[model samples]
Target: MSPQRFELLIGLYGDDRMAAILSEQELIASWLKVEAALATAQAEAGVIAADTAAVIAGAAVPATIEAGRLWRETRNVGYPILPLVRQLDEALPHEHRGRAHYGATTQDIMDTGLAVQFDAVGGRLTELTDAFGDAIAALATAHAHVVIAGRTHALQAVPTTFGAKMAGYLGELARDRARLVRAREEMTTVSLFGAGGTSAAYGEHAVKVRTRVAELLSLRASDIPWHVSRDRLAEFGAACALLAATCARFAREVVDLSRTEIAEVSEAAGHLRGASSTMPQKANPIESEAVIGMAVTAGALSSALYRIMEAGHERAAGEWQAEWQVLPQLAALAAGALGTARAVAEGLQVFPEAMRRNLGADSGLVMAEAYMIGLAPRLGRENAHDLVYAAARRCRATGESLQAVLSDMVPGEAAGAVAELRPEDYVGHPDVAIEAALARWRDRG
Candidate 1:
């Protein structure tokens, strides 16, 4: 069977989810696009006659090609480019066959083909990021005023706005989008340096070929020969995995929130969810768990990509093939993770009532910070801490309110500071961070 057919059958593992990036139509379309680019580059540099270039362009249509036949030739030649070059050769009507591919190396066409795919994949990633950003913003808007006890060491340490917590995630996502954007450009550059990592075939024509190829493909010209660096390829792969890690973290948070005992938040579930024999009433977060599971594998693939960077010299077949396996898979998984993360964020339900109900453990003593601040002017900083420390223990152990505890320990100036304080006065400003995230996304297009 054809490589294209294989991908269609197994590329997405039972979920077509976001496998368009690896589809026969998409991958083969990239090859056709690069062939047209090669034709354009050759014609612009006077290497191929204008009329011949036109014939080559007319025949590069993706839909007209036989994918199975191309795959057969590729398998026979033991290289992916053979099918592409042979197909281009047959379509040239004999007159332009000799001029096709011109002075370009195999890596040149392969890298260009890869860039075309990156262009399409980059667009999808941007859309996924945007959808997730909208979801994050909605969460921030909805929870802007929900006060919750922020914890460290699994114990409440202070009051924080739930919106503020989401703001931090929104900030991280903004940075992730920026990194993905840069990785897209890095992956999309034209590397037309000829065979053996040099432009020897083109000779004095190398500069013209490089410049024209970049212009034809709307990509930057690679300065040094990147035919074998492999680092750029790995960086692109690593970025995808890193984005997956972010998705994993988001999924983990959802899982934490959905825990029955915690109940501070929950993933919205439908009637058919968790319909297994054992747990009919359960609302298991299968999507979140699936996304998190993909993240673990994506991280491993990322490490493999970096290992390929150690494949030094002109080229290493083993390392290159490893990349072909890992990078596309990483991209596919990242796309799925981002898509799932956006959905979770969009439908995530916050229960301020639950947060308030959960805060009974504080016994109104989570307001220790306010009391500390209130007494800072009275007993001096050190003494006020001593008094509040003594009083806080009473409140925690005996379930006493701060007001009652403070009555016994009130110092001269603290009486004045304590009168103005309230338990609800300590929530921090989370809306500022949300606005910052929204402003960052405005320039995404």
Candidate 2:
């Protein structure tokens, strides 16, 4: 696809809320907000006069800074905080000019700004994940008895309910959501250690000022300096990556199940939705495809985040710069993927009849395990396995029904068990598993 086409598609399906939260305007605004909070906190700690802080805070709005000039100076200075502080200082009265940024380093404001952004992003993602989880829970409950073929290595293995499958997805999503919540909580702590990871410039009121600033920003205060300890942020990235990867797994399953040959499930249909350019009959799983793409992109970005953890002691030379470019994109992609995943889950179309038909596709080959397990108690496990294997071979070679071949192959004593091997009866305890998943989801909620 062309860049224009990609952008258009992304805008249509991507998480616009996340896009707005991570936009340049919002980022600059967050930085300014942090600067104002720092000034107010310093005043509270007696590092600066209240009136000076008031003047600085009044001038700390984003409109006081020029975007074009800010970028120009940022390019020259290799950081934007100084340019931002310069503009804020310029906007303040001469007496209060030097007090605009007040003992805080660039990382302090930037990192705290990120925490604010993540607070917003985390809330959005958590909402989406919960929505998706609810959808899966409903599906699992509704389809608790809907038998389907369980496959391994891309081929039919045994009977299983669609509810059980959806329960598995719910379980994975719940775990990912928990990880994201923990990471967001841990990563949202304040970053007020000065340039050298010490409060040398902050003097006696450093801890007080930092704690007050954190409180003002609605973030956690940490005494241990994190100027070089990037693990918390990386943990957040890893959580997002895991969530995206799980979304991709679900999407891939939808894509495979909705294929022309399988036709067991589909994304919701609409007029020309997911329409192919030339094939008039095609209605593709486009949203799921986009989810898979976004997940892959998030995974790749997460690698860069891990590399960032290798920053040298006390400061990152070039690694920190990459964060300005990587983190927002990574977060946006994860949100997009998750938003699309929720849509897919809520609008999914399931064909139980098709699932049943497909289960009998290879002449009841999918139920081979049912027969094996049925005879395992009568015959030894190895003997039952060999018998089912031979019967399966005969059914395949002669195009005969597995039920018929297995019925004739089983000893007379096991004839009753072979006769009872219906797919619905063979789907083991899906209701119990679905209930377990639903219980966990409720607890999370």
Candidate 3:
């Protein structure tokens, strides 16, 4: 194992469960599992002796294999499967030696092993994402009516509920959850076709042996050999990228809202968690920042996975090799981003008073839309817009409040309507949207 400066960063960004799923030991164990399942399938199909298959299956574990020897052999052989099969056969009695690998090819063993690893990773990601979604839903429900200034172009435009913002995140997370579940289902299939994907080695019992192996491994049997069709892996990567983007979106909002001037929301209190080295007063949004960093890396890595889809012929050379490096990193980064997002959601701090104070900071200017809407029925849409625009200019020029300026410019009924408008009153039906998001989450659960 080469020492890397970014190893600590990767650990912080990634989940321990995901790390275990993609570990070298686990990867080798998955390969052994595939080999064992293949032996069992061949035995059942009468292609190999039952006692020989049992002996092979019994020896299919990492503990029986010498890691140092396997590594050296793999380096010499240009792939791990040849060495792995050699090690497995060496572990069994001489009678069972030749039956260890049977009809399976290198791609069949490696691809099926990768599918098992991905299945585990997908399960963990689904659980984490569900927890994150629940946290977001709870936040939305708690603050469903808490109004804050809505910003556009980094300036206040109107009033919106904090719950509405969280609800939007929850909704997107819901869709992401569904997408991940589908990707997991699609990708968790056995790749058992030999050599050229025609299963010529297995002959008449190809489909039956493939199906039996899939059952033994708890995976779906592929409709055809996907030795060259990489869409399944690509689709899974795309789902992960979309999930990371959603997490980044939420993290960015937290970063923006936690700004010194905004102060509407922040990470939960921590004495030194976000402290800067030189700046004693600094309490940064470190979790959100880390999440964004992981998300950016995942996005870049996902592009590589997409590029690998351009494989040529029955098998690829460089494109196939590229996935061996890219997929694990992409999975790790995505899982890391999800872990950070979950932490942020569970510990988020909301300051309702600060949100209200900021809403009024512009002296009712943010409520201009409300005033315009109220006046549109009386003055016509264009005329009402002009009237509000002129009042805004006068208020700025005379250093008066927008409400006072509107009171002077409009007649009794229109002025009454403008005077009656509160920032909270203008936050149209965000609770309904929140309810919809919550309902969707519950239904999915």
Query: 1-445, model 2: which lDDT tens digit per residue?
Result: 1122356545777788888988778889989989889899889888889999888888888789898899888988988899888888889877777877777889988988989888887888888788888888888988888889999999998899999999999999989999999998997898888989888888899999889989999999999998878898889888888888999999999999999999999999999999989999999999999999989988988999978888998889999887877777778878888889889989999999999999888888888887888788989889999998999899989999988988888889888767846788788888888888989999995
Judge candidate 3 at residue 102 and give its lDDT. 77
In order, the Cα lDDT scores of the candidates are 0.76, 0.87, 0.88
**lDDT tens digits by residue: candidate 3, 1-445:** 3343466557776899898998889999999999989999999999999999899889999998888888888878878999898888888897767888777789999999989889998898888888888889989999999999989998999999999989999999999989999999988899988888889888789999999999999999875989888999988888888888899999999999999999999998887989999999999999999989988888988888867888888888889988998888878888888888999999999999999899877666898988999899988889899999998888778877788888888977666667657888889999789999999998885
Q: Provide TM-scores for the models.
A: 0.88, 0.96, 0.97
The local distance difference test score of model 2 is 0.87
List runs of model 1 lying over 4 Å from the truth. Answer: 2-18, 63-65, 386-396, 401-403, 406-423, 443-445
**RMSD after Cα superposition, model 2:** 2.3
Candidate 1, number of clashes: 0
- C-alpha RMSD in Å of predicted model 3 compared with the true structure: 1.4
Clashing pairs in 1: none
Q: How many clashes (backbone N, Cα, C below 3 Å) per candidate?
A: 0, 0, 0
Q: Name every residue pair that clashes in candidate 2.
A: none
Per-residue C-alpha lDDT of model 1 across residues 73-119, encoded as one tens digit per residue: 77788666667777777877876777667777667777788887887
Ranking of models by TM-score: 3, 2, 1
